[model samples]
Target: MRTFWGLMRAYWFSDRWREAWTLTIVIAVLTTLLSKAGVWLALMIGELTYSINFYHDAANTSPLRTTLTSGVLVIVLFVLKDAVIAGTRSLVSATLHRKWRGWLNSQFNEALLDGNHTHFHAQHGSADSGAAAPDNIDQRIQESIKGMTGGAIGLAMGLLGVATSLYFVGENLLQTSVEVKGLEFLGSYGSSVLALLAVATYVPINTWIAVRLGKAMERLNVRLQQAEGSYRSELTTFLRRSFHVAASRAEDVQKTMHNRLYGDIDRTWARLIVVTVGYNAFEAVHNFLGYRIIAYAPGLVSFIHNKLDLKGYVTGAEMINQLIGQCSWLIHVMPDIATLRANSQRVTELANAIENVQQPQEFYSQSGRSDFHYASQNPVFGLTIQKLELAHQGEDATPFLSAANLRFRRGEWTFLRGESGCGKTSLIKAINGLWPYGRGTIVFPDGVKSFYAAQEVKLPQVSLKQLVCLPGSEQDYGDAQVASALHKAGLGDFIEHMADESREGKIWDQMLSGGQKQKLVVARIVLQQPGLLFLDEATGALDPDGKIAFHQAIKDNCPDVTVISIMHEAVAPRSASGDEFYHSVVAIADGVATKKPLVPNLPRELTTILTQPRPVEDKWMRFSRRLKQK
Candidate 1:
């Protein structure tokens, strides 16, 4: 019950609460008045019949006027009661549906921003459970809220009607000596002698069944939801893996999933069927016994005129009105109570996860002064490691990189060279504060900002201008300035074509090649021009000539910014004579960056270049085939 009210409190204070509450009160009053009027009409009909017997063989003119008036009043009350009820339900449904949608959207956005989103995958496996959102959440918010709110309001009104009807019927019965069998207490002032026995026999039994059955149904719903999510995920995977599963022979996998899903559905439905049958049978027997107790008392009288009648029509009408109100209230509330239980469990799970404490040794400590920067004379950039460790599955730690502490200065270029899977990319991510499963303290100046590009950059389904803005606004740059930045990164062609494009930008990610995407990322760097820049193989896809040109552009545009890049084989290619065709290629082995000359006399080659084995590839493919004819 506490869980039920906690979940519903949000709606109680919403804008629609005042209007909804007003309508509920109005509907309750009308329902009670109508129930009373119905009992009066029934009593009038019985009296009119008795009057005809007393004055037979004449025109029945005296009671006709009262009968006609009671009939008209009954029709008017019934119509108004139904109309108000229907209108209140419609308004509540609309308000709850809209509120739930907004709440779910807000939760999704906060989860993404507050948590370490990229690193979360490394620790938490995947958030790809099929029961996540737009399905389970959709049902909870839409169907669940309606059931809960309506049920609460209906129950309160129903109980009020039942209590009032019981009072009036008991009071009127005490005025006569005619004894009611199931209500022997009606013979006294404070009636309870027989009414107490009937209520005590069934009230507890009914309440226990209602609560226990509702809990079981809630469990069944959760299992059914899990089955649906699993089935849908499997179907989607099958379609993506092969377009023609029938021809490619994936029948066995599909059949296996079908059998599993079918089994779950059968178990859930079977449990629900058993409970439903038991409850309805019990209710039917209970109602029958209650009516028999009342009717048999008059039949048992043995005197010549012993049968005592105190308007059986009035008693029956009142009982039926109270029964309908109680049943309606229970039926409306059953779904809400079940939904509130499930939602409460989910919220408690999330709260526990967020409140978990972190260990003291789990986080690295800061040792140096408050603002120890990378460019300071005795520069110790955060925490540097003598050796870094990583372990494979069930294996011991393997040393990835080992080196003495090295100094980094502001406005200096530092290049890391390594083969694929040699931990170069991981190092860059560690420095930029993304992947934290390593031994290092990448300390930054307290207030300085940095920009970095990983191997795979994600662009939300947004426009080109928005992608290049990078932690800032697109409106901050003029059209001419955006064009200039694109030109420097060798992506001017794409920008010119996409200038007047629609905002959707879905194909922009796929229509552009790897090199084109990297160029756009670099354009963002030129626009923001952060204090530090980190690149994880950012220019790996560009040709040898394009690589050299990109390096020159970065040096010219942002001379004061410190830049770091991971070096790979595609940096610059060389000619057969070992002279070189471009510059900036380097060879790194055993954790040292040794520069290798890839081109002849391309600025600073005499001082910065070192010797290394040349990377070989077919050279004749560089020229066009059409040139051979000329």
Candidate 2:
């Protein structure tokens, strides 16, 4: 309960709280007005019916005209009431929906992307073993925000309407009386007391049922979201890697997707059915008891019979009794309230996850590097790693990199080389502040811009120009400069295609090959002109000559940029003639790193002469020669 209210308070007191509160108040006011108008309309109809049945003959012609006038007035009031209700609801709901979605998206992005906290992507996991980490964060930001905001607004408006109904209906019932066997059973105040008792009894039971169903719903919703996300992720992967899957003839992808949908989704749906069935069964009983209460009560039946005997055919007491029944709106809104609670819990859970990911101390601490801090005010240029030690995530005792110290100076190109799984990528992550399971201090120059090109490139579904100028706008670079960069990266063919104007807004992913995609990523780096560039097998798909060309292009385009590359033996520079390409090489073996100058190559004759063993003289001949000389 505290958590539920906490979520509401956070949203209602947020930066846009004023707008949210204003909309809420307007909706509430509109709902109250509509409810009152509805009750008035109902009363006017009842009065007309009473007059037509009981007083039609005694009334003068003027009374009939008055009734006709009242009917016309009621029609106008009804139309106006509905119009205002619909208008206010539409305006408030649409505004709130948009506001909530924007706020949630900002919060999620800040938590995940800001401050180099991308490690959260690797660390996040669900408590339930059956479920995976919350990968459908985009879905959550869209669906959960919409569901929570709409549910909360609807629940609030429904409660307001119910309150208004009760006030007018209860007041009307209190002004009338019913009698049984010449004895008055329920006067105005007595009927009010009985209604209050009925409400008191109904609220607790309704709340209990709602609470139970809400808890079950929250759990099932989490699982359902996980299952749905997993299924969708699989489908997306299959689509993205369709060519690879076909070439490799891998059947497991299909089988895994099947299991995710049939196995995980089926289990969640089955549980949902059980909870829904139980809730509905109890709801039916609760409704049955509420309607039967007036009939089964000791004095109520006699009261109704006596009212039936009076006024010839229709009775005023019967009308009042029916009006009092409008109080059931309070009971009927329980399901909506429960839905609101469940959705609020889901949104709260996601917010908490973001909060947890932002706080690194909850998982690990960087104790050795406590004294080291990046000073944004007086940032240094280049990269520095001091006393760095990183352990694999969730394994404190087993170190991945131990006590490694390295440095890459400004405007220098350093190659990071190691066998697979030897922590080269981990070192890059540590340097970039993405991996927090390490004790390290990585110092970067003040106001230094850095770009990391990963092994697998991710291109946005935007135009070719926008894709190249990403993290900035196309307006930041001239079309000529963009074309030049693309030409240098071997994507000159795309320039004409991009210049066609018709293809300006088209997605270019499907049109580009694997090598072309890598080249495009290089083009982005050239356009970004970062002071520091980290490449993790960024040109893995490109041929040797293509790799060399792209590396040369970086140096050519951005002369002073520091390049730190993770490369295999095939891609690392092989000849002393190309030694200018790299300043040094840092090799990782086991859990240790060693730095060496980039020798590139030695002459084959020198290598053979140095590596081959010298011939040895016989020990006896050497001893005899030494004695003779002495």
Candidate 3:
């Protein structure tokens, strides 16, 4: 309960608090007013029924006139009541859904992106470390947000309606007394007593059943979401890799996995439906029996009989009985309330997970030294790691990287080489402050801009121009500049085709090959020209010549940029006629990084090229040289 309220406070006090609060208050006030009006209308209709049945002929007013007037009023009241409810519900629900989703999505995304990326992924794999992180996070973000918003609105309105209904209806039933002259049991208090008795008997039973059903449903809902998410995730994977699957002739294997996942979903859904149907059916029968008990109570019947005998009508007792029968409606809505609670629990769980992910924790210390500190000085340009050891959270026994000390000078190219699983990428993560499970002081030159291009490229589904100028506006670079960079990265043909089609906005990933994607990443580096760039197998997809061209372009185009690349093999500067592109090589073995100079052996021609001074040419001079050669 505390956690639930905390989640509510977190949302309500978020950046959009004013708008959220205003909408909530307006919806609550409107719902309360409409509910009270509805109760009043119901009570008035009951009184009118009694009058028409028992006192119509005795009154001076004509029976037909009174009946017609009351009928019209009833119709108007019902129509107005329903209209108010529908309009308020639609307006409130739509507004809240949009606002709440936007806020929640932003918060979740910020937490995921801005926090420790390595820690986040580690938690997903290890339950002990990050037990609070939700599974199928994509589904949780999408579906849970919808459920939380809609369920919260419905639960609030339903409770308000129930409260108002009880207040008005219960008061009417309690005030109207009934007496039987010949009966010694339950005289004037019969209606009130029976109403209270029925409620007292049924509420606990209804609540117990509702709670049990709610728990079962919550468990099933979790499983159902997991199954659905798994199926969708697998489907996306298969579609993305359809060509590969076909070429490998593993269609049968993929199809079998798909069928098995879908079967799990189908079976889970069937069980959920069966349980839901059974619960509803049972509730219906339970409500009928509860209502019948009050309606046919001996006290109620005796009072009605005596009233009919004395006054030639039993309108008072009949009205009271009708009001008492309304108690069953509360019982009927118990399941909905339970479902709401379950949904709230799910939302609370997600909120907690997000909170856990975003909260800061003390950094893990491996060197047992706290003497290292970073000073905030001007013009930061390099990276320094001292005694840094990183391990996955809660896995101190097996360190990903251990006691590694390294320094990268400004404007120098360094290559990182290691066998598979030797923590080359993990070192990059540690340097970027995305891996928190390391004790070391990594001091970056103040105000240094760094960019990392991963092995598997993730191109957004946007225009080619947007993809190239990502994290920056396309307007920052003119089309001609973009075209020049693409050409440098060996995408001149792509630009020509795009120019013919007037490619204002188009997704290029589908049309591009693996080599092209790597080249595109290189194009991004060329365009952005950050102070420090980390490339993890960024050119692995490209052929040797293509790799050489990209490396030469980076060195030529952005001479001042520092490059740290992780690769399976060394990136030789042979393309530059052995003019030593990399200043040093850092090799990782058994969790330690040892720095070494470039390979000693080289061709005499390559060695001579390294000794020669190369002339630097501007872009225009290079262009003029190319024209002359042509």
Candidate 4:
């Protein structure tokens, strides 16, 4: 109950509180009206039955006309009630649920993206699971929220109708005393609410039985939801990488995995089905007993015993049946209530994760960690690291990069070369303040922007301009400037697709080859040129000629940007004018990075282009492949 309330109560406190409260109150009022309508409906139904029975006789034809009139009246009123109910439900979904769910989703969106998207994942075994969104978060945001919200409304409205049922329908049943069999003691003393008491006891007793037997319903519901989410998540992953899977001929493997996952859902459903059938069987007996209690009442028994008016017996029995049905509402919706609880538990988990994201506590901390950085006297636009150490959180404190001091300056193309899985990216992450595992001082240039690119970029399903100026906006850049950047990144062939901003970009991410994708990222970099660039093999997909073009493109567009590249191979590149392409290399061996200088010149001019009449045909040919040479 607290979990349900925890999710529901937050909406009224949000910025949309006025609208939220207003819609809720409106719905409540409408629900009350619907309840009143239900009471009137039961009263009219009894009257309809009473009038038909009263006028019916073998000699007179008035019985047929009366039956026709009463049946038509009842059906018309029932239809109108149903129509109003439909409208009310639509209003509730459109206004109340939509706004509240949207508000809740926005809060989660903010929290999940809190740590610069470090808090967001697909329930994958990456980062801290405590901070990430729970399993099947999309469904939680869509289906679970709907289940909770709509279920709450249904329960509330149903209860209201039941309360009205007691007021109107129970009025007659309570006034009459029992005169049938052993139940005579019920009203022998005084006029008593035999119907109300019977309803209260009978419904709950059966409900208790149903609950005890079907206790596994909540657990089964939760298992089913998560299992379905797992299957959908895997299916999406398979589709995204279908080309590789097909090439590797792993279709059979994927099919087997999918079957196993689906089997889990089927098993959970099987358990749920048994519980449900048993519940309904118990409910059927409970409801039949309901009819017996009201039918045998003295009010109806006297009507028949005295040969009194048929209206009395007819109306009394009708109202009494309605009263019992209303009282037994809980048993009827028991399965829905169980599902609501399961969904509530999951939604609450998501809410807890979002809460943790907003105020993240430290995972790991060491003494004097913040005091590592100090001001440097280096006259360059780059970073300085002193005694830097690296390690993962929740692991042993033996640092990977132990007490290594290194400095990189502007006008220098430095390579961080290391063996595969040797913590090159970890050092880069430390420099950028992402990896808080190890300690050291990382001194940075003030008021300078930095950009970090990894081996893979997940291009969003968006337009061309949006993809290029991602994490930014298309309106932020000019058309000519974007076109120039595209041409510069060797994606001139893709320029024609940018004409329609509304066109989907999802296909491009899949259709583009690795080299083409790398070129697109270069286009992104050229669009938003940063002062310091960190490339963790961002150009791994590009060819040798493309790599040379990439360096030249960066030098041309981002003149002052300090490029720190982590490479596998060692290549001391020299220009036509005897200028070094890379100023130095930071070789990582024996768990420390030692700077190895390859250039004597402090700031070599990197403007040696094909326009300067380079004698080497290879250099000239590579430059010709670039847009500027064209």
Candidate 5:
């Protein structure tokens, strides 16, 4: 319930809180009125029955006038009651989808994207297993959140209305005395009191048993949701990597993986079925016991026939059944409550994981660095790396780099040159506050907007202009600005397709080639015009000439942009003519970063030479590496 409230309180008190409260009050008042109206309609049936009985008597022949009037009124009340029910259903449903569920969907969706469309904390599980995002956030947003609103809010309000209506309708149950054959003292008590006593005793036991069975179902539902999410996630993965699977001819391997995923769902679903059957069987027997217990009270039939009129007896019977239904509400919805708990728990788990990921903690016992705190007021150096170490993310992994220092002067384009698997991306992420595995400070300049263009470019299904201007409103940037950015990034051919918005899934993804996708992202960075930009091998898909043009375009358009390009040495190479076109290089090797003057950085050779730091004559004696003959 604590976890349940964590999800509710967010949207309940959100910006639409005023609308939320208004709708809540409207539903409550309408529900209460509807319940009262239902009670009135039930009583009107009794009055109608009395009128028919009155007309049946030969002594009172008024041409059935009173009976006809009563019948007409009963029909009107029935129609009105049903109409109100239909209207209320529409009203609540509209509010649920548009106001409550809609708002919640957008809220959690934004959270899932982490406001960057990055889905960093969402797709990647948190460091702590307990605080990780639950599998299949799509399932949470689509189905579970809907269930949460309906079950948590709608069910609660509905139960409240039922309870309120019972207070008035229960008056009919007092018309007769409940007398047990063996216990004649029961006759001294009104039927309502006896009914209440019976309910007070029996309901607790039934509810206790229902709850016990419900608990197992609750745990089962959580497992079921997880398995379903896992299965769905596999399908999504298969689709995303469909091209690779086809090209590599790994269909059999993928089929086996998919089989394993669905097999989990199948096993969990089987368990759920077993539990559901048992629960239903118990419910059937328990509900029968509860309903019959009051109906078969000793001497109740005699009391009804001898002491009450036809109307009184009929109304009493109806009210007694209604009372049972009202009292058994919790028992009836136990399965729903269990499912609701499971959905809300998954939502809360994702919420907790995102919260934890956003918090600044000890990345190492030594601590990790983020760009948030270490902002320098000076403009001379746009960004500074203060003794930052690089480490991969895992328990078995240790920092590969020793504390390394460097500075990026304002408007400088510095190449982050390193060998493959040399933690260049990790260093960039550490400096940009994305990585949480290394220690030291990243001195980000104050009031400087930053953009990171990753190696893999994904174009969302939207207009080319919108894609370029995304993470920012398309309204913010003019079409000309977007078109110019595209032209600058070697995507001049796409300018004609600026207005082409593909609403169909991944159409734009299919339309654009690999090089075009990379350029599209580059255009996005250029269109945004951030003061600081990190390009993590973003030009990998482009040819040598295209790469040269890509770099030149950024320099030309965003002249003062401080660019840190993490260059893969194999891809970028060591010549100015090709991808190695940067003037400065920060080469990371030998677990340290060195500020080298040119491309073809000689740090690896320098470190090798420095390790032989013995006197020339006794070098062989001091270090085994410098053996005389060898």
Candidate 6:
């Protein structure tokens, strides 16, 4: 509840606050005026009928002018109030609906940004594959917000009006009954009975049913969301990989997605049927007795005793009419109010999941190499490798990376090597500040900017030029500059052909061969030009020839750039060219890293030179001293 309030307060205090409140007040005033006009009009007509009946029976006192005038006045008031109410509701609904939609969308986008959309996916699972489905969160928020907010606010106002009217109407009925007879009804005891019955009967049962329904809806929502995701995946494949899906005969995939959606809806409909039927039965039987039969009972008994005429009975019925109408509104509003409460609770939970939950302790930026730090303001220790950890289900230790410590200074490449499941990717993510599950520090130059290219790339709907430019960037690049970079990465031909075509959903990540995609990833590295580059399987997709060419391109293009690559191959070839090429190779195995010999296999000449130690003249051996200085 507190979480929901925090989210709601952000909007309630926004610039739209005055407008929303004003609309709310206008709608409330109009609804109240119409309801009172309806009751008064009914009473006025009853008075006119009683006056005519008296004139006919007594045959002396004529009240034709008074009766006609009162009847006309009541009708005019009714028409005017009803017209204003209609206009007010239409205007308020139009403005409020749009405002609600815009607010919800903005909130959702902000939540995504603040929460780190990438982090949420990494922790919860992919947006497509997570146990808690995010696919339909947007849809659910959109469809539910307007109805929930408007209905909830309206019901609240209606409830307030009902309470106020009940108090005053009970007082008026008591005074009228005292004037007409000795019977003492419509007093403290009567009002208490009615209020007690409302609370005891409607509140608890309706609340329980509403909560249960919300849980069912939430489950159904998850299934429907999964089905939608599956359908979208198939659709994307059909559009981009038409030949592949067709050749593979993926009709079964399409059919299965459709069947799942239908099945979910079918089950939901059955549950809804039961819920609606129960609600209808309760509303009908309760309103029939409370509003119609019981309300008129007092007036009917008075008429039989001759203590009240038809006029008095009609006037009493008018007061009863107000109470009955209000009660009917309450009955109709119960289920929706419950649903709104449930939805509000969900919104709170989502807000808490993103914002309030404490994260694992991370390494402070101060404890890193002063010269090699990446955008931190202070310095403490060089190679500040702090505690490394990962979060799993419910506080159990699932160590993606454990007490790992390895650091390299400027002017060297430290290759992290590990067998499968050694947390290579996890290590890179931790260094990049994407993995908060681990607690550790990776000290580097304070102002250095780092760019990472993961194994799987995300390609947005944009031109090849804009794709390299990065999303939301305004830095424009000319065709010549883009072409040059593409040519260096062996994609110049593809760019020229695709320049004029829309590349939206072109499957750049999936359609391109593994090598081509790797080249593109490297091309982005060149284009973005970060000082420190962390490549996780950045070269896995590249062939040997492509890998060598791309590596050389990076060395030639960005000599001052520091690169820490994860490699499985021997470091001898990379180091053999010069001391600058490979001075350091840190091998990470079984969740630990150590400076070790480069793996076996080098070109025969280089191998012979490295194998046969020549005094202390070896460049790599001499360079070890240089590393120790930093």
User: Candidate 3, residue 154: CA error in Å?
Assistant: 1.0
Q: Which candidate is the best by lDDT?
A: 5
* Residue 505 miss distance in model 4 (angstroms): 9.3
| Residue lDDT tens for model 5, 1-630 | 136666776666888878887877677777666666676676777777887777668776673787787788888877776686648855775675466778877876676566443356445554444444456777877878787777787566658766776776664455444443345565645555656666677777888998998899999999988888888888988898899999999999999998998888899889889989998998888778766656345226545446456676555555555566666777889899999888788777666655555544431222233223355657656788777766655555667975467888778777776667767787787776666565677788888889888988877777877888887888998889988898888788878878888524547888788888888877887788889988998888888767777787787778788888875543233334333345567766777777654434443333333333122445334455544445
Per-candidate TM-scores read 0.63, 0.81, 0.82, 0.83, 0.84, 0.70
Model 5 TM-score on a 0 to 1 scale: 0.84
Best by TM-score: 5
Please give the ranking of all candidate structures by TM-score, highest first, separated by commas. 5, 4, 3, 2, 6, 1
Q: Is 3 or 4 the stronger prediction by TM-score? A: 4
Q: What is the lDDT of candidate 6?
A: 0.57
The local distance difference test score of model 2 is 0.65
**Global local distance difference test of model 4:** 0.68
lDDT string for model 1 (185-302, tens) is 5543222233333344445566676677778767765665556655666666676455467887878877887788777778877876686666566556655654455323322331
**Residues forming the 10-long window of minimal summed lDDT in candidate 4:** 605-614
- Alpha carbon deviation, residue 469, candidate 1 (Å): 2.5
State how far residue 272 of model 6 sits from its true place (Å).
Answer: 3.4
The alpha-carbon lDDT assigned to residue 11 of candidate 4 equals 78
TM-score of predicted structure 6 = 0.70
Whole-model lDDT per candidate = 0.50, 0.65, 0.66, 0.68, 0.70, 0.57
Lowest-sum lDDT 10-residue window in model 3: 362-371
Give the C-alpha lDDT of model 1: 0.50
Worst 10 residues of 6 by lDDT: 362-371
Question: Each model's number of backbone clashes?
Answer: 1, 4, 3, 0, 0, 9
